[model samples]
Target: MNIRVNGEKIELSSTVKVIEDLLVFFELQERLVIVEQNREIVTKEEYQSTKLGDGDEIELVHFVGGG
Candidate 1:
């Protein structure tokens, strides 16, 4: 399916179906980030079951350490 990720248009891989899968697909499983899908904030608990479809908008915000 085609999804817009952080303003970039890209096609989701065939093996990706859920938010969790997408994270792993991008090697972000262990990263500290917040995922927003279609303008809705997706909680960590929802990642496993959140279904991704065509035309979806996904934004990933990574957390950075600061002094």
Candidate 2:
């Protein structure tokens, strides 16, 4: 499936069906990340259950620590 992530278009394997899977695919599952799908903010608890589809727009923001 094709989805736009952070303004970039990305093609994901069929195995990636939910937000959790997408995060794992990108190796960001363990990071402090916020996900927005199709203009709506998705809570952490909804990641596992939030389904993704073709042409969906997703914005992922992850915090970086530096000092």
Give the lDDT of residue 62 in candidate 2: 97
Write candidate 1's Cα lDDT for 8-53 as tens digits: 9999878899999989987888998799999999999999999999
Q: Give the least accurate 10-residue stretch of model 2, judged by summed lDDT.
A: 25-34
CA lDDT scores, all candidates in order? 0.92, 0.98
**Candidate 2 TM-score versus the reference:** 0.97
Best by the lDDT measure? 2
Residue range 1-67, candidate 2, lDDT tens digits = 9999999999999999999999999999999999999999999999999999999999999998999
